[model samples]
Target chain A: MAIIDSLKKISDTVWELPATYKEGMRVPARIIATEKLVREMDETVYQQISNVATLPGITRYALCMPDGHSGYGFPIGGVAAMDVGEGGVISPGGIGFDINCGMRLLTTNLTLDDVKPHLKEIVDLLFQRVPAGVGSHGFLKLSHSDFRDLVEQGARWCIEHDYGWNEDLELTEENGCIPGADASKISERAIERGYNQVGTLGSGNHYLEVQVARPEDVRDKDLAAKFGITIPNQIVVMFHCGSRGFGHQVATDYLQTFLKVMEPKYGIKILDRELACAPLDSPEGRDYFAAMKCGLNMSFANRQVILHRIREVFSEVFGRSAEDLGMRMVYDVAHNTAKLEKHSVDGKEKTLLVHRKGATRAFGPGHDEVAARYRDIGQPVIIGGSMETGSYLLVGTASGADTFFSTAHGSGRTMSRTKARKQWHGKQLQHDLEARGIYVRSTSWAGLAEEAGPAYKDIDEVIAATELAGISKPVARFTPIGNVKG
Target chain B: MPYQYLEDIGTADIAFEATGRNLPELFSEAADATMNVMIDNLGAIEPHDTRQIELSNDKIDMLLFDFLQDLIYFKDAERLLLRVRDAQIDKKEGKYFLKAEAAGETLDAARHHQRADVKAVTLHNFSVEKENGGWKATVLLDI
Candidate 1:
């Protein structure tokens, strides 16, 4: 039987894989997707999510969002919350290697009419200013000790250094700096790899795009106006990136540490080596958590600096200061991260370690953690699509607590990069996008070819499923007008 | 080519199978495969700079895993694109030790045709085994 056959339908958009379907499962596995998407999902996602279900102290259900796909230990778009007081285990695999890899959106006063004539110039300048691709380095020059302070301080450091406006921090997740970042727990190699990579857009599905919200794409006019997407053809800038090499090295260093101690020291046996973990309160777990926060801070700082450079680029191009251009931030949301959040479990309030790997936290309205400005409307969720396709701006729904207030991250990959490269020529794709009025600049032809629109699932379909599932509600859809691909 | 990318294994990352006649050869071939994912033209990376790598692990598979991560470390930390020129693997005190010489230059996008920025080596289905009287390793690189 197909794996889909084993899933018991819970709703129009939710399916459940009972714990009995897999041995050693602590809880059932649930996937949030429409019937069509569930059938089209890669077989490995089921296996991987089932593996995730077996981890220690997992609560409720191991959840997979609509954009779920096969990843190493947990399926991309996987969400699992564990009760720390109940011997909950924290796995590096659960948060992913690129810690806090997330999306950021900035609303601009310009419109398509204002930007069309200067699309190429803006994109080209962004491509140059925000270095992209493999071996790309940012313009920042920080000493070893300075780098340590930056990670500990996160985007606040950028504000102090004049890289961002002070108001920007309030709109960012965790006020742009996660607490408990101990540079002492991080490896020197991680610091070395990361100190110079601040502000760079790393390659493989990462991009900096300038988009527009046409009137027709606004699904909820009231909500759209609240989120600053009111102007027809309103131009906005969005980008996806993470901690770069710094996060990768932090995860790698801890993965090695956990592997050496997981079984012998902790007596925890995992089916996959990548699922290696330790108890949340264990010494190894606390150290990794602290180091991981450093990765989170590094990324927050990374995007903060990129936003600074972006403000400069836009200012230089349009002959107006970024402030005069009204480049106010919408919100920044992290897709890959683990956070300690308070949620009601079995009708009792509890602090849970919520792990969202390739998933975004969609905190509903009135949540205490929601930014004060958005507390009434709920947290804004930024879902990035492929460069050829468009993206969406959604707000968390009150009903989203079902999966610990988590939702889909992107129009997740439907094909492999190697296969996409084999199927499309980069130059031709670039020409095609240009003919359609979407201008692009990329560092590698092969990299561009690998991210063709057809290489991913339909963005509209993914959005429709999320809305139908009530995990997040669409506020507006933005069409890409210009992009800088890494 | 001692290595070939596995097209069907991973949809979001790059996976490859590498083979060699001996332990050292296996390590070198895997190193080349990992670097090849980043730079399309591995041969263009001249041996302008060199670094010696020394790592030991109780498990043989992790030894290969560590060696591959070391290559990525150089690319990220030093901007050096290295390929293992030679390697020696030995067993002592129940641990496997690897010592190797790697050579390459700081990455020049104008000279080196870059591809995806490989993030890390994932041990999901990662394996190193003796196959058909030679050594074979299946690896996945997070890009």
Candidate 2:
């Protein structure tokens, strides 16, 4: 309570903890949220974000987005930019275990009425086609070498292999493939763990859903139409997942490497073991960066393949070709990543390594990084909510530079998985949801119970904070009609 | 049961405490806690297969860390659900060494009532210590 009281309110939606709040901090820490959300935030988030402030090369402030919650070394929704030339370091904790763990949205011309009768059929087919749950493997079985190729080429490889449309790449962040990925940097064990996991909707909060946007839900009808939400009761498919075991292995392998040398060789002592990092210029850091890119690409390919599967299911259930149904990609956004980008620091533009763990990159309008087609409208930001509550589609704002152009990724969890499971029975919840017209399918009943809407913070409030802060603007809200939970 | 899931910590992940009378027992208990996060029914995992594990680390904590990571690796790589059996830990020349056997069957979703997927072991608040003349460990798993 004392810590919360100490926060200096900068605005109704922004609070700052001065550099003096903790010892060894190089910069202040900021939490972007309304007063109520800040009051309800877990205490660990403050400690974690403060710890992030102490990392070398952290510039401006260590920030937590509106959906901030307790995570490992960096709070979920944490954002920190390191001055690469000023002793900035790259930490695996800042990037997260599920590298490039992100969201992808696809728009279809079909309205709610057209999809209502076949919701269950479409969801069931997707559940089977897109592997889900623990130890689940994707349908794409690649050899060790081909798997290496896939990670390097990313979604481009999927297109070459006939898993996606050519346009899908243009709509993906970084064109679905980032540069500097080297398969040789990845460990053999990591390869073994990730090779068959290209298209899986891994368990523990990963999911695929069929959502609808009613006319009233479109807050900015013109903006929503520009991003493919043109039809009333428009049907859209969105899924949250990442590189699976491959990316986890990549982060694990690098974290252990960094921990071994962070203090001894690099002289970088971290407050928490999970915050292990190496200087951006160090051999260890460069190697991990290259390897992390592989993980990033792997996730792009994973989503690309999953999109192909979704198209197949929709076409099958509706007895029409995917193109005929107007299945076009809205956008794909990665929630966890570290990338080098130029931004204003001290009124001078400098290249900084921005780390967004459990946060989304929200580049504003006219930025070259925005896809060419979307340059005039800004980048699309997909924010996933709990399966039961629905999700939102937002656009980056010019004023988002306050946090280096980062925003909340999801409705951050408010309860632990065990507690949620104990409180909600998955079977009963499923039936209850079905009665409300939201058909549900999951790999495990217990996993379903853990994701009950009550376990998470209010998504609308989180979005409202972002808008007030001028970080991103909401275009439309989507209510789920069918879901495939992992 | 030697292990119990911790409710107050790791709101976004799974956390648990495992206790044992010795290092070997501590490692085994910790392994069970990790696997339990993925599969709810440990008894349902039959010993239809076996894996031998050998690892060593200068720090006792990392020794436990490496052993638990090996189990998760097998699960993701081969879909093998395992339980620790006959784990042996010894310290020589200030370095800790672990040797063990793990047994279970390849995961069959139809038979094994799966739970949340445990991504990896996080070092956040992860510890191995002596408590009340027994070895105790706490682990938080990224899910």
Candidate 3:
């Protein structure tokens, strides 16, 4: 593809497509990936990033993370920072369909050995209580008023309902809640979609996993200790999900609104209709931002409630209280979102709306957004890989702030889920993972097959590239023992 | 011809094209294709529960988008798995309206086997067109 020929090697871990390479690009598009990964990427990704570059108020660079893959409007691993002062625009496509779709890590004092015999029961109990699969629900009834407050208060509301500990909020992004959330902006249909799915794990790529960290996998022992992970085979719980239909509706509502007004009113032209957007200061833009906060908060509460259910299952299985078992949250990161943050642009600080579609914000040390305790160390960035491949833990670095404090979210899909399914049988893939010391529990076997390890880029290479690029510092690596996929 | 899954589409998402002799038949086929993505055995779904859905838009494309999204909303909201049994598409003044009565029972793990949970019908590569003598529309769902 011409897009491949246009890419110029910037460094060992970075590539750039200059503005001159594209017709309407206002800024260069920078990609953080190894040479091999770059070559493997499709031309559609290049076109999408350049399309983002042409948008109004986009500054610095239209950044694509290492796991970058072609997506609807922006590449899945895309990042863009737009200046409101410069008429920065907000695109629902930029924020992604699953708003605040993120990762949350919880550490426990217990190790793999402590739960060896009861592994099946623990995993089974988790799958039972969490309500996995398509169109799933439980008895988490909510009144109209309660639903409104849940979106406004986020995980705090669930904590008040005894779903989790108060400390959980502190570890979550935006303290498990965001400001400027107006439930009035949300539609009744959106509220209804989120009502029954508060604690549910929606299908496809969303899962609750139980993993163990080996001491050998710990890269920074000091940083690992600070995160309450120091021992080999230290059991940890990590969940990957989002706001379910709630977030989808929020994005849908705004995309429709933006679609109707983008060209005629905002005068923002986009190559793909999926990239519909409005100026960040417009009424439509403000409405989406506010509604997105509800989506973000809904996800925060969803994961918090899932965490609560996990703690209860562990407490019951181990015959001890959750706290007694030392089930402490490590950190929660919203890998999908657009937040207003002050970033140094050309050595001058500017408030920008940084949209991290499939990228994680890796705020370095001294940034106030990092937890007070972690302000010195840095924000914890959790990367969930394929079920068979291991995951990684990294901390933001000073050198990483170039792309508005962002890094790769996961091993971007190298192949399509359909290709994966065509290559491997779900039951056979489960057997293969089992042979490799991982347990898989999924509602749909076809879904399980779609997520086969080879379907994604190598986690080790992706993390290595991120570390080498100084975007994030590696802390630890985790291997899954049990995974619950919806 | 009713509808058929577009297997040639990308690996991660799903798409289908529905054809009908008329607008309402096309609407029914589109709904069938959308619901089939969740669970393929339409005959297995007992039509014991019925939900009425009504949507109107100035554009036929948005009307179809709204109709499909409405199915998903009900799926997530009331845990309902429905297929359109009867549908009508009409033009009042300049606005297009769709009214459909779909019948299906609540999702039961004991009965219906689950497939991919379509997050939403994405606008990416989405289109509704008039082809040959009937109407044809293609939609891609973000699964």
Candidate 4:
């Protein structure tokens, strides 16, 4: 892997490899990272991003967020908007296996002091109430017909069934349902796999955590107050998950089908087969889009059910109603998704298919998509760090418009899992986190150890890079007090 | 050969490292490792049928994903529990073409110990590279 010597340093935080660096590159590739982080990257990331640059109809720039890492076709943390009217291709790899894999932050009126007395009970209750680990199933068993409806309606299905609050939908991305999900497009095998998995947390970097708000890091006091983070030590719950097997199957089914259809039918020549795609309006592309939407809605419904379960557990433990606990959703945003959005490209508003992989939507203040309540303050971007480190809450910025309003999703892995396991022990890591007053519950000890805090880049540094690059602005930081890993 | 767990990436995810003297043996060992992750027994699968699969990809890593996905598809859709018997990979013009033969039995509760029904093979943390005098690949299957 050779470095593209033609890359020009546009700023301390931005670097660009012009289109001439590779053949068929529709646009230059812009990487948002500090010099130090850029140097630390594996050359595979550059190669992958460069391949992504070569995709047809890519608009503006093939942008890489600060946490960029090598992936199958597009680099993780990759964002690229393709002009649909100009023969753009929609690749399943661009959206990733975990469709709508995202973060949701919930605020609580209880303070750190209030939770300290019940930390053990709360963690236990969450672990018991929430089905986790590999192949875990929930109490909800959907019939084939109901499962299809669930996939089609998304969180609305949950709300209609009294599993979620009506207000929660407004705070969710796309009202927690992307329209045009064709349940009929999904395979029976996919439906079977998803039937019992709803409301369950499948394993691997998926978790539910109890965090203590650090008052010192509150940069937007007014906005924080509006989100019910008024008290300095208010406790909150944040979790990261997605559509599980349903999303995986949707991505898999499309990737294979697209590979079979695109080259023969559309004559689409891809830099990599893993990046197989078709025109957004093409039959194959439209089918994938519809199926991907099903995965997205399924995830929203999954999280909604989990939230209901959380309310139940809180009610049981505190001897108070969930309403009294103030367990209200602040916001839920999808990181891995593709949307047809309007963005200003070359001083003109153009419609493009924006694919965000391992990146969050950072719509700036006053954007109509921003919830009315937070319209003046911008969208709340929850970036989860490693279990041992603290995660940050950032607000979208106007500068993000230049990059299709995207930001890094997490701290991103620094060490390979094999290397991390050989270097650390899960039990010791658990003990170390416990010493720091962060309780952890996981099914596999080795799994816990490999995701040790040190295996990833310092989230603070990543956030600082994003802020310095003007992609997003930090609002507050939350330190982990308790965690439940699948 | 002895078996060893590579690492727990996060949550219920786990990877293992294995080795053999040649490509066929190595691929067979990899298939054994993958099946072990999903079930408890491989010896119990009767060698009643044989299947041949040929796949190609621009990269060896992608070929590995395709191979694993093929196995999972057969297992889920056709109820076939397969073991790779032989494999040949050729790299030309930056692409990998693979021809393989596998043997296994139809799924039967008395013959197989099932763990998790892996829905698909994921590209997450997937790798395949030449090592020593042979080849090695690591794939993350979405279970």
Candidate 5:
């Protein structure tokens, strides 16, 4: 394993490795982390990040978010931008298997006190109402035609089906849809795999949590007021999930196809097979992008349906209509994805393909891309911590634009899941969380054990690093009171 | 050979370790294990035509990923039942060059049982380490 020695500290939270550090690297690799966090990283992360720097047409810097971990080709919390017109490459590893796996936060009118007596019931309701665990299927089964429309329409399909509110679409990244999703490009196997899994929380680290809003952390007072979060101790529902099997199949299908086409037709030389790619303008690349968009849309639609199901459960359990109970979407954001955007490079505005594997877009206040409601306050960046810890809602800042308006997505794991299971017992961890008022329900005990608090870095420290790095500022803190794990 | 479940990282994860004398044998064993995680049997697929795949990577682990990806690609795209026939790996200055031959036949649902279509090889908990004898690799396939 190669070690990165003598990193030049750019600031209190930013560190840089110049391009001369490695041969064939087009840009420098920038790591956003504290000294302690940097030291804890496995050598593999360094190798992967450096390899990412060597990618074709990568611009400015190959950036590492605070939650960075050793990934296949690009580190999990990796960010890289390439000039689209200048022969940029699109690697599947950069987008990840889960595609648009992301976080959605919803605020409620009820306070923590109002739900104290029924916390367990609410948790049970969510666990039952939301399909979870491996191979879990939802009630929403769709035909090929319906699935194609869902991919083309995204959350708009859900809204049309009356699964979500129209306003919710406005608050979602890209208005809950990405254009140019060609269903024809997606393979039949990929479509079949996703047919019954849409709206299901297929297993592994995906979860739904019930949280209480902390009074001290509401930074956007006006926005909070507009969202009706005026009272302290208010309860909220936050969940993290994504495109599920559909995304995975699309990624798998395309990665192999890309590898086959990369050398023969495109004349591309790859540093890593896991970083299999094709030029963004190539037929293979365009097809993958279209397929990827389908995955993104499927996830958006899945989440919208899950949100509707949650609303139904809450209404049934609390004896109040969802509208009266204040079940409304605050915002939703995709953490693992690539988007075509305009950014200034060397004082010239250039269109680029920005891949954010485990990073979030944090467009600053007043950006036209931001929703009309949140344009004045910046985009809401949801950072989900481990189930046993607290999640934070942050707003994008001006400085974030320098890095294409992106920030760390979560706490990032400090220990591997295998290591965590070996070190701790799931049942014991469940007991401890319950003792702390966090009701835990999971389909698999072993899975729960792997996500123990110790497996992850402290989210507070990760958020603090982001704040100090001037990428995003904390808007609110939400401590989980109950959680459902798939 | 059978894959023994090592541990679970979360709800759907089950880690396993397998061993073989050579690259082809090791990949065959690993594929059997991955399929075992999803279904019951791999012995059902009939042996058929040999397919050749030549891949090169800067690192051995990536070569492993590509090797497995090729099998998945064949299974999904070509709808064939693939099993490793032969494999050779050469490494120099950190780069791994590989040539592999695999065999697969037409899938008969009555014999070959289809399980979850593995979506992609995940970076989550992916590893390839050299052991005292040959090479030991661990990967998490997103199913």
Candidate 6:
């Protein structure tokens, strides 16, 4: 592993791959992981991050969180900030294919004990209510103009259509709407592909899981109380998905264009074609950002609508109003996105394009961009683990700002899906999870095999690494009772 | 080589390679490889329907990339799991053009065993090259 010798250990939990390690690097690449965990990492991530450091106008450092692993252009848990004033660039690889792909957590008054007997019924209802898998269609029929409005208005469109409550907006990142979204920048092919998939969970690793938060797992009492997470075994529903094929098409469309224009228009060269990018101030960059915003909005709408469906299921099953059951959103965080923000760099505030691919923002207290209620405590960072292993709820800290306010997105894969499938048969794996008290509901048994729990890194350990690194602080933990996969 | 999925070593996405006697055959095999990433049972997709696609590009690399993107688009938009039944590539006015006919049926999950949902064909490690008497291509898919 290149990490063993080439990178210099900065701290017990941090390592620095110096700019001198590679030929074209303008900035050093920083990684947050212990020596024990770093040994599992191969040279691929070192290459990708160093390559990222070589991009024109890359600011400060190229960073990878504790859960970092090799991915397409950026490592899965990579974070980079570029100076827009100095001709910084934006690449689709930095945002990933599933634009605004994120996790949403909603808390309820009902506890695990209260919902235990009806767990199977609730999961079954969610599976039926929300269409999933490839080609899964939703009843959100929209005309061209309506769809365009959806792309523009985001979750607000669904709330206006009575799909969800207006209050739900307040709990979402960017209030469930990203600015500068222009439907005009979106292609007809992308619109057509997104039309039917607006409210569906399009496959692989995307799921809606019902979980329980025990009093014992609440690490921070005050914060957990603030998040409406109280009582032992409190139930919360969490889902992971994105803009479906709409986002994919948008990324595909831009990447091809970037590749065609990179040399002629930007006078920039990259180590890999997958890292194709244009200056942030250039026409190509602006156009792709506009199109990407549309993807962001579409995903917001998709999740809002899904949340509405989930609330309805709870209301129907428990014979109580959703509000009475305290079915309110805790927070929503987009993992794959690039946002323009003002950050203090080298003691001066600069407008930087922060690209977090498979990483989430962990802005600490007093950031005005965060929700008013959470402004004093910082943004909630949702870290999803495997179905059986449970998940974590962490909060941004003041020290986290060093990495430009970012943290690991999930328990990164320790093994590939192919290997997981080879080792475990889907039916048998399902039975095993059931034996361990997790109900597995998926569109395909074969798909279930690929997501077996043992394939991922230890979630508890990854969370501990981040906390020890002083990037983020853990507040609460969740164990899954039931889950529905696409 | 027809087509085969390479086990992912350092990445989370699916990677595969395809080879054939010519560019046209290589594209067909690549299509098969792409579809196999989604469904293992190609036999389940009966050839009762057909869709024709004509794509033109100055570069062969972009042409193949766009062609693969089209298959994913068709599957999502039309719910059709197509197999390239016929293909022809020609150079017109110094630009490359491809015309192909694909046959398949609407995806019936009960009939077909589905795998990962390939989101898009990625440019990461994507390539097309000539080797021996034939040509080969490598693709990585984001799921």
TM-score of each: 0.99, 0.99, 0.96, 0.86, 0.85, 0.98
Greater TM-score among 4 and 5 belongs to: 4
| Residue range A162-280, candidate 4, lDDT tens digits | 99899999989999888999998998867766777788776667889999997887877876787768888889999988887778878988888887888789888887666878899
lDDT of 5 at A410: 85
Clashing pairs in 1: none
CA lDDT, every model vs. true structure: 0.93, 0.94, 0.88, 0.81, 0.79, 0.88
Candidate 5 deviant stretches above 4 angstroms: A1-4, A217-223, A226-228, B1-17, B21-28, B31-119, B122-143
In the order shown, the candidates' Cα RMSDs to the true structure are: 0.8, 0.7, 1.8, 5.3, 6.4, 1.2
Interface RMSD of 2: 0.6
Q: Candidate 5's error at A147, in angstroms?
A: 1.0
Fnat of candidate 3 is 0.52
- Model 2 agreement with the true structure over B1-143: per-residue lDDT tens digits: 58999887878999999999999998999999999899989899999999999999999989888898999999999999999878888889999988899999999988899899988999998899999999999999999
Model 3 lDDT on a 0 to 1 scale: 0.88
lDDT of residue A454 for candidate 5: 75
Ranking by lDDT: 2, 1, 6, 3, 4, 5
For residue A336, model 3's alpha carbon misses the true position, in angstroms, by 1.3
List DockQ for all candidates. Answer: 0.84, 0.87, 0.57, 0.17, 0.14, 0.70
lDDT of 6 by residue, A12-110 (tens): 889999999889999999998887667777567888888899988889999988888888888888899999999999989888999999999999999
Of 1 and 6, which scores higher on DockQ?
Answer: 1
> In model 4 chain A, where is the ten-residue run with the lowest total lDDT?
A442-451
RMSD of 5: 6.4
Model 2 C-alpha lDDT per residue in residues A427-474, reported as the tens digit of each score? 999999999989999989999999999999999999999999999999
Candidate 6 per-residue lDDT, tens place, B1-143, comes to 58877776435777888998999999999999989878879878899899999999998878999899999999888788999999999998989999999999899989988887889988888889998989889888888
Q: Which whole-number lDDT from 0 to 100 does residue A182 have in model 4? A: 98
lDDT of 3 at A53: 92
Tens-place lDDT per residue, model 3, A63-96, is: 9998888777888899999999999999998988
RMSD over all Cα atoms, model 6 = 1.2
Better of 3 and 4 by lDDT: 3
Those runs of model 4 whose alpha carbons end farther than 4 Å from true positions after fitting are: A1-6, B1-27, B35-67, B70-143
